[model samples]
Target: MKKIAIISALLPLAAGLCGAAGKKPADDAVARANGIAFKFYAAEAQKPGNVFFSPYSMYTAFAMAYEGAAGSTAKEIASVFSFPAKTKDLRAGLGAIKKDLERAAKDAEFVQANSFWAQKDFKFLPAYLKTLRSAYGADAMQADFLGKTEAARRGINAWTENKTRGKIRELFPQGSLDQLTRLVLVNAVYFKGRWKAPFKKEMTSEADFTLDGGTKTRVHMMAAPGTREAEYGETGELQAVRLPYAGGGLSMLVLLPKEGRTLADLERSFSPEKLEEIRKGLFNQKVKVFLPRFKFSSGYKLNGALAGLGMPEAFTDKADFSGMEKGKRLYIQTAFHKAFVEVSEEGTEAAAATGVAMGLKSMVMDFAVFRADRPFMFFIEDPKSGLVLFMGRMQNPAAQ
Candidate 1:
């Protein structure tokens, strides 16, 4: 199967906020949800692999479900997602933030989509539908989950594939959705940006990449000559670099851990506050940088991981999605997420999509010389909305 991932670990250490008062609440909500997400990753350190995800995708998909959640179900979802106490505020903040993000992506093909699917004949509450349409830009569509489950699955997969520019397909997989499925809230985001200071293709050459286990791997190292001033930052354990795209509105931030320190080590101690410190302290300097050419896709089964974040009620029979329908019979059965990213001398092409079976539950700047020759953490974001479009760590750049 292709690489599809559930996004919960994208921004364990992202530290930036929205400037507008209206968007601050939404940013705060995502920030808190990030806390739970990274914590879940730390708790599941036993799983072996590099971290990759789109937390924004997961947050928005869940927010769609949270709108219809009532009583403890709503409370649990809010607590898990770190939403503000009031629903009105959450909606307003999210709306402002969404509009700002949509506006800030002129430089990149940053497309975001949301949708709601319910079994045919299910009477969805008007207020719930309105919340999805108004606050999340989603329209509830009736599907015959009981009579045409496979067709419904293919339709959803097709929608996700189209929205993601064919980057994410087969998100639900065979039999993942069934006749018992009541509702699914979907989110898709696509981003492709060319670096303002593109690396010359001729400069890419063979280099040795050191893996965490002390294994050496041959990879294509991309070099950028030290001519133009670059923004950079470094502390005891990390070196950071900011590469602006064709338009200055969006950029990619690469965080390389110092020698002898592993990306896993930084992840264990990382936080939004620490990321902020790095962003604030960067300086402009002349430096030679080497980044490996990497391309890979990732997918995850998030049911267990999300349950670790608290809010198991949303996944089980106890889920209360009454805001969606009169009876408290709907619950989330499964959730799926897939992400794709490619980094070359030209620029970066990344896309991510999320699906929530609500059947019922569940950036920076600095100046300094930076070389990302080793495994490192990176994020592509639009600072205006304080939303991370893609976040992942590269272990073996040679691996596709």
Candidate 2:
């Protein structure tokens, strides 16, 4: 989906208010959704340096997390992710989920109740009408609909601009938005920091990268000797690595196609469940990493992928968004997602509050530098919510 603009006025009035509140739980939900979305994207991007993440997965995860929090009829929640032929299955899913939440509620019940509306509804059973009215005014509700539509557009544009450093424009195009839209949520997190150890420009040299179909391309490679955690795993035929962030709380998982393996194979096998497995199996180890400072821009149309994932109803005019109003005509017209990412180990400098060098050299260093010259995957997440707001893979930096 090149331009994904979901305007969901039917998003249970309570959910919309909770989402708009910008509370910790909402933020956490967004982040977790982002993380799940990124994993799917990374798996797809692992193909032969031509990988593009799926926007459908990102949108689905976001909708699911929101549904998990907002108390909506099982059918309503499923509609947000896509439509289901049998509402029974959705109710079953919700029943199973409710049981899980009931157990979790026993401990940290207060925090859970406050953070999750579903839990709140089950526990306190607040007056839904009063909460809805207080949380959203008529004007605010109208504005929310308009704001979500525009925000979705802005998000795709921002990701494209940020990743490509301003190469792609209007990923969704103009006039792609329409009313009766069911849902629109976006998360844009960026990290532009320096490396603890900078690469020497003179040491950078041309290197051969194995591409798909037994092809080879000469690219500039940077090498650094540092204590870094690395891993090797498989998403079908693709080989991947997990690079931890500075705090070790989160990691950047990079997937690369094995020699002769196409990126498509990896994308086909990508899923949130698989990603969680990969994350759990990641182990910390020391290694000498060699990578290129590369940049590349990509655009994707995710309608097909999303529809394939059991969310087919939102795409058509037949979509029922009655919750938005007793009688209203609304459906998602289009979904477009475009993103760009550049990774280069070029030197970067930053100032710190304390300037001290507690080393053998005893020299005061007031700045930090970084050079990202390798194809890498990265995300910034909240430790509590486990959300990943921003994610990208950079294969070529100069081109971007």
Candidate 3:
């Protein structure tokens, strides 16, 4: 597992560093919390294959502790991870991640691989929860925290099954979850909307889609007419485009290889910063949106990724969580995250009725064209906390 390497690298540093004299536990806590969040996104981006994980849920739990312990050492702990003494504006840093999120969300094939990993990791949840409570104090934990944890776990499982159209079950199997786990908080968000404008199943025709190599394979390409926010740029020799979400709060970003360049070359040049720039510069423009009707799922084990990002002490059994409770043995054994998303022409619908009506008549015009043909990334974030509630990548839409 990738986590093994992270632990190996940080064990030495964790042992050497003692609690700074009169150091506030809150500061360390926040640092640890934010470190974990940052690592999830960073690792997902660095991993060779399609990647997806939820840093939002993880942050929500940590945020609960930060809020509950406000003015105490816990607040400082949250700040460490959140503010990162060295950074000026954490929001700016997060905003820059729009591209990566967009890529992960839109890529169908990547989503499938990610969901497989998430389901596999669900098997170890029982032992994982035990380790959490043992390290953090029972008093420091809240009843709501437990409830949310359970709900989030179940919600993800349901989403996984739904996204897979019932092909997979028990994304997190029974007997895997625990009630007494020392969890911080739970953050869950589910999005199941059809495309604003449904494609005429007949319009979908097989076409050649360029892959990583020079080979061109036939894929079912879904074309539509719509107004989408996008940007044109030349990062080295590749051509790229950015697709913003409804409110412009987040976006789906794609990098297409220049005529002669291969997808591999574009992938090689991809970076968090470049992705950010693409998002920042996006403007509403009229264009032909061609994509594939694909579906996929993804799962991730974040323990190692987080540790490698400079949060070593929390994962080890010897780690100190006294601030949460004096003399309590607390260490994070495993951090598991999973997500599922589908983008089609079929959107969501709601209806309301009034007791008194005058010749009631209603007309609804719900039309949108979102064709996700190539690999793309996406994220659902809490605008206030800058917390990423859900994140995923899809490379295939046909699976849906």
Candidate 4:
């Protein structure tokens, strides 16, 4: 007899209708909360140089895994991610956003995909699998982790690479997964879109960009073909602007620290509430835009960072994820994330992938020339949903 029983069997669902028995939050509130959570995440994980990652990707992957977690392990994850107090609400809210994002994709080449893989020999709770499949659109696929660890790793990496249009590769690094691995949850998000008003390639020129420490470096600065009307705002601390993508639904919100201030200063004081204030303060006006053309990729081993965010129990043996399976407990073994982004005269192309290996646990902008000659923060987001697709900072575009 089979140790694990497949109830409904994995089937593709149009949207996540995870079987949580509560009302979902109202009007993109879950996405907004995730955005706010990312603000706190940035404050904790950001370093001195260029930094980029997809909070959306991380949130979705973790949310899928969180569905299978039990006890304090689940509570810690909720605290760290700012998930809704009710499991049903969180699932419903995320499902709504997932459906909305799919609809929004018509305006841009935006794609988000998720999958859940379990060791075929292991026994997981049927309810856990059902919630993941229904609420997250992640069908459960049985993998031979004990006998084919390498093959399993390759299979997961290939799925991520394909979903991200070849932008992100090898999300599970060498030796990252081993025989003890029993489950893996993955999420990939990719976006390619042109600006509503693109900068003419001819207008791009070599310019001196000042670093926070008074160091100056040469960078290819892109300029809008001419003055354009965009969402703009400024406080005594910084200048902010919104550059819409091809569709008005999404935009890059850029925040530039004032002359006497530094990126660190802006980051240190930032919060989701503050971001809301900035969004409310913006006005539409014609402004000059100056952005640097840069491309870079960032990868992180998220165990330490996530622990620092107050979810230490998820990685330790004390973790209770019995909801995933009835027998031996599974703790997070590894959490990995990789992101790639390129901003240029034509538009922007960005991709990100996040993976959770059981054994496992883991872990924008804008414009305003509105000139980004100095270091600044940027976010690619859905103005209507208040979902931030990407968040990053450009310290030295010349670095990579």
lDDT winner between 1 and 4, please give it: 4
- Among these predictions, the greatest TM-score belongs to 1
What are the per-model C-alpha RMSD values against the true structure? Answer: 5.4, 14.5, 15.0, 7.9
lDDT of 2 by residue, 1-400 (tens): 1111111111212111013355533333343334335444543553444333423224432332232232233344344344233433433432332233233223211110010111111121234323223322111111232335466445434443443334345554545542333333222212333333445567678886644344456788877655454654444454455544433433345655554554455556656556557655545455445667555445444445445544554444444434332332434344444444444564221100000000000001221112233333443222223343334444443443
Clashes of 2: 35
Q: Each model's TM-score?
A: 0.90, 0.53, 0.54, 0.89
The ten-residue window of minimal lDDT in model 1 covers 7-16
Query: Candidate 3 overall Cα lDDT vs. reference?
Result: 0.37
Residue 115, candidate 2: how far off, in angstroms?
A: 20
Worst lDDT 10-window in candidate 4: 1-10
Q: If the candidates were sorted by their TM-score against the true structure, best first, what order would they fall in? A: 1, 4, 3, 2
Off by over 4 Å in 2: 1-49, 52-171, 178-187, 195-202, 226-240, 257-277, 346-400
| lDDT (Cα atoms) of all candidates against the true structure | 0.71, 0.37, 0.37, 0.75
Q: Give me the displacement of residue 244 in model 4, in angstroms.
A: 0.4
Error of 1 at 100 (Å): 2.4
Q: Give the residue spans of candidate 1 off by over 4 A.
A: 1-17, 20-37, 40-46, 360-369
